[model samples]
Target: MSQEATFKSIVCEIFGIQEGDVADTKTPEDIESWTSVTHMQLVARFEESFKFQFDVEEITEMDSIASMKNVLRKHGVDL
Candidate 1:
């Protein structure tokens, strides 16, 4: 799989969403599996999966798949 696919897979699995349903338009409001603890868990998972750290602000601000992609880009995740 490509990096984008890897990222999307990680996010989708962490949030308990199907890969087919995990689009850029997806948001926390659209996923019942999303919650504060879920976000923190996701942050940790992303850090481990990407082998880089992210600021809490960035973590807290990721309310959508698109936002997560932006954060990943900002951290030089190679899209």
Candidate 2:
């Protein structure tokens, strides 16, 4: 799979949602399982999925899938 597809898969698996249903606008407020603890889990998922760790600011800026992709790219991740 492409990096984008893998990223979506990780998000879908972490949030218990369908990959097809994911969008750039989706956020914590839009998902029932996206609680504080789950947010940490999602962060960890991203780190593990991409094999890179995010700093505090980067973690906080991961508000949506679009932002996440942007952050990942900023960190030199191709996705």
CA lDDT of each prediction against the hidden true structure? 0.84, 0.84
> Which residues of candidate 1, in runs, are more than 4 Å off?
none
TM-score of 2: 0.88
Tens-place lDDT per residue, model 2, 14-79, is: 789997768888888888888888889988887887888899999899887789789999877777
Per-residue lDDT of model 1, residues 6-78, tens digit only: 8878877878888888878888788888888888888898899888999879887788889888998898787
Backbone clashes for every candidate come to 0, 0
Model 1: how far residue 5 lies from native, Å:
1.9
Return the clash pairs for model 1, or none.
none
Clashing pairs in 2: none
